[model samples]
Target: MTGIPKTYQRIVLAARPRGPVAPENFRLETLDVPELADGEVLIRNHYLSLDPYMRGRMSSAKSYASSQPLDQTMIGGTAGQVVASRNDYYRVGEFVGGMLGWADMGVSDGVLLRKLDTTRIPLSTYLGVVGMPGMAAWYGFNQILEAGAGDTVVVSAAAGAVGSVVGQLARLRGCRVVGIAGGPEKCEYVVKQLGFHACVDYKAGNLEADLAAATPDGVDAIFENVGGACLDASLARTNAFARVALCGLIAGFNGQEMPIKNSRLLLLNRVTLRGFIITEHMEFWQQGLQELAVLVANHQIKYRETVAEGLAAAPQAFMGLLQGHNFGKQLVKLI
Candidate 1:
């Protein structure tokens, strides 16, 4: 990339969203794909991941992770083939996944962008199953909550990326699984496709009643994704010494504040809650990727993604993810 492009597609934060993100908050424009130096690689993005955590990145406030700069390209996970390389760690034609953001072209030093082994799975799979979400489920189950067979597991946002896999993995472990999603369709998919014993829809109302019916025996483990009312509902059914794997808070992604009733439920139940971003244990990334490959090869796991075509639709698709409008793992296809 001696002489890079004068303009490239990018999604920028025009303004901090007060509530739900609107089209006005994001402004898409063209910018230069910076020239790569020695030991750097230039990648033409073929796919970009849209996760719920991205919503918090738009704000300028201090968070668990650093916030994205205003009027700059939105931060996101992406997968693409390397087009230019100057490092031995990466070579041209190799696919990679990392924080490439929403851009048509990206230049990185391979520090953040890890070289992906495309031989094991599809390039897009790197963004879902074998990527961050996969690592998230592994960490949440194996390390954080430490789930096991005979445990009753409940997962919120169970049709989404990490939650979906967590629910299914619990089922494979012989644990009773209950999923909480948004609507009838997603709830049905969670039970039918992900192999959950039952699925509850928060949008259908009476969260307490639905959650009670779903896990009548009391929930022993919780793979938490959506917070707020859903969190409250889960707390109501938690058994003694319940382990809660705090994954994400997509419930607040819409910028709406959620109220948690009776904070004593955690203290009363002796619940052990562990919050994580999945990157905390980068050491387990390889382990997760390898294990997921075995599962995929053995036909023990299933996955899905909602791909949005074109770079221009990236912002809208991203917003759609925050609203639970996306059916599965959301991705933007560039080429």
Candidate 2:
């Protein structure tokens, strides 16, 4: 609390994007910090998470979550330290995770924020492997796909936060895992470092052929992250009774239309496709968090991150994430 400041800088939604989001869509503002009332806690954010789902929140379209209001602090996940506190539960100098948005500092009433133990793992890990993205891969892989050993599993956007975990979990379950990433570097990292059985570079202009070659036995489980060509290619290679966990549609995030042309493949293959958001299944949170933390702790899972240096770089970093420019998890370091 000794070095805590009285004001902070934050980014707000200045305008909705007409197509792909740009830096002009956001505005930065400096403001006086609010005095903490009884039961309120002040947080000084250390890391801000950049995710693909955020693109949907920018548009005023029907989505599982409500649209982000204009001129408001842009919505985000943050890991930070409690700089000051009047709340009985949270203490000063303790780390916490919350939806504190794109702010250098924030105040909360101890509602959504959760205390974190930064002693064991890197504090930023809470924003990636041990956070929402990890929970997403956990639920999608275990609950939705119910993948079994010896199954041929395929995951798109395989180098990303959720996709990387999905591939690793599937491989750990004794499945032959194949990943689809954007470039040769990511593909190499996916197969060599992450231990996926194979990785296809979708940007190589051989998606259908490469995927077909990779999953020669046909895909038993598909974790669909990028929707357009990747989903289409996976659908074409599905075995009967295949399970498809539809995650993020990063391919069409810039307002491109996503239409399924392989209708016959689904009926012929008897595939099961389920789109899920981790927030909807609160019952699985405890189990998922425990398993994810354990895997991370034991080194059974590997993760990577592309860190943006500061809050001002968040907008551009996020834009890069949408284009598959990030090698792994995209994050903004605010400290």
Candidate 3:
């Protein structure tokens, strides 16, 4: 490959967090680009996705997936262009999305890579709305929630990547959507920008009352992202036979105990709650991505992003994301 850099920078997981993740948990290192194997592909990562799931991966505690190995490039999704290829299936100059981790560049054997089409959707979106986050929204709404016309759907962390999509999708399905976000700005964006019916500011110190006022008909479906108070408030407003898709528990991600205060409502209201990991259902990804791509390309589905420039900013950007400082999808522009 002509003009390929001899060395690249990558962020490695230097230490496991005892509680909240800090900058010290990651270490930046420079390494020589590895020689590609007979069936390998070299990728120059343009963007690295910063997701809440990566927080769980940082812990050694029992989880659905293995803990991220220490001193290794921190695991993450990336969108990039192939700089070199030794495989027939993928060619140099092709755009791709893969688990390339937090690096300026990486090498893969072509097994984990998926070719991307950036004609309509931007390449960075493949790591966002038309990618895993979008898939999670689609699958959770359509399969788990099973919401329909006249249903009141409440989405926690509604201004974020997955929650934003979930609310929009529910609205498209003729359901009334209410969003729960951090502050006035995010709440306003949820209602005005994302077209949600109403948005509750969870930071206003009146979550339960505000949520109740917003969801007058009671919440028929919930796409829960932040648990703790958000979940408790939503649970208190659940309608009979209400469906809940528990996608993330960001409120408790920093090792806080966030027990549900309204657990009795599950039995009282006959609520059906299901927690899912999107990776566990890879079969529906293609179908969901196709639908999401079309909607996004047509502008029926709008999304936002908060990008931090350079690979060096990932840890700080990630910390911001955890603290709800980001507007939507958070990414590190590695290029």
Candidate 4:
């Protein structure tokens, strides 16, 4: 065994919640790190992204992949600086992206972790805009939704990590952007800050009307985020042959299972709905990243992160995200 001291610190999935995940679902545990094999590097985790999909992973049932087995370390996508390396590909000063889960430190084979240029983009960007969230926007808007200039594009969760980028990119493409967020401040940010043409607040108790007022010509494309009432309302207003990209359903994350309604209406509306995973669009990553970097560098786009200071506070931060309490991207700064 390579002489790397063993240590353990993990958020174990103690139990699956009956509804939205609860604090008890995770228990902090400490264990020894396995010795680093050749071609492996150890990272001292810096920032861990808290995404909506983590909600599904917490459930003990199958969704996209294997469920987080009970009593095991929870899974997450994290960015960290390399502290030790046995692989020439990853030096001690290099930053990396990997399945590091939620811990202060972790070891992985060079295959699972990719070196990142921290000088070009902040390490945090690897977990958001220049990373998975950016990837989600590239595929959802360009490939899945196929958004076009002058087309009316509506995106729910518009002020979030993914939706925010989608809205700005569609606007950059000369599309009319309409965004749906939870409250008035977020709505204002979407319209005034992100340059979206219109925005609505689903929490206003009149989402349907506000939504209608935002898209008088009807929506040509929609990037769905909160998928209960918002999805239903968007479907009702879709333009002929409109397209929809199903990204996430935070509405159902808390056990509010909304039945897919108006299934027959797709035949009438000629709407095309596609569900996508960001990993599927690995090919288009560079094209999107190059553009996104320019936007960020030029201040054409902005991002907000509701950062939680310690790894121990991650569960609370994650819960806030699922509950719409977070103002923007949710993250845990372990370093």
Residue 243 in model 1: shift from native, Å? 0.9
Q: Which candidate is the best by lDDT?
A: 3
TM-scores for the candidates: 0.94, 0.98, 0.99, 0.95
Residue 122 of model 4 has an lDDT of 86
Model 2 Cα shift for residue 53 (angstroms): 0.7
Q: Which ten residues in a row have the lowest lDDT in candidate 2?
A: 1-10
TM-score of 2: 0.98
Name the lDDT value of residue 302 in candidate 1. Answer: 87
* lDDT for each candidate structure: 0.85, 0.92, 0.95, 0.85
- Write the residue-wise lDDT of candidate 4 on 25-52 in tens digits: 8899888876678888888888988898
- Model 3: which ten-residue window has the lowest total lDDT? 326-335
Q: Give the C-alpha miss distance for residue 209 in model 1, angstroms.
A: 1.1
Better structure of 2 and 3 per TM-score: 3
Regions of candidate 2 where Cα sits further than 4 Å from its true position: none
- 223-304: candidate 3 lDDT, tens digit per residue: 9999999999999999999999999999999899998889999999999999999999999998999999999999999999
Encode model 2's per-residue lDDT on 271-307: one tens digit a residue. Answer: 9999998899989988998888889889999999999
Question: Which candidate would rank higher by TM-score, 3 or 4?
Answer: 3
- The residue-level lDDT of candidate 4 at 60 comes to 65
Candidate order by lDDT, decreasing, is 3, 2, 1, 4
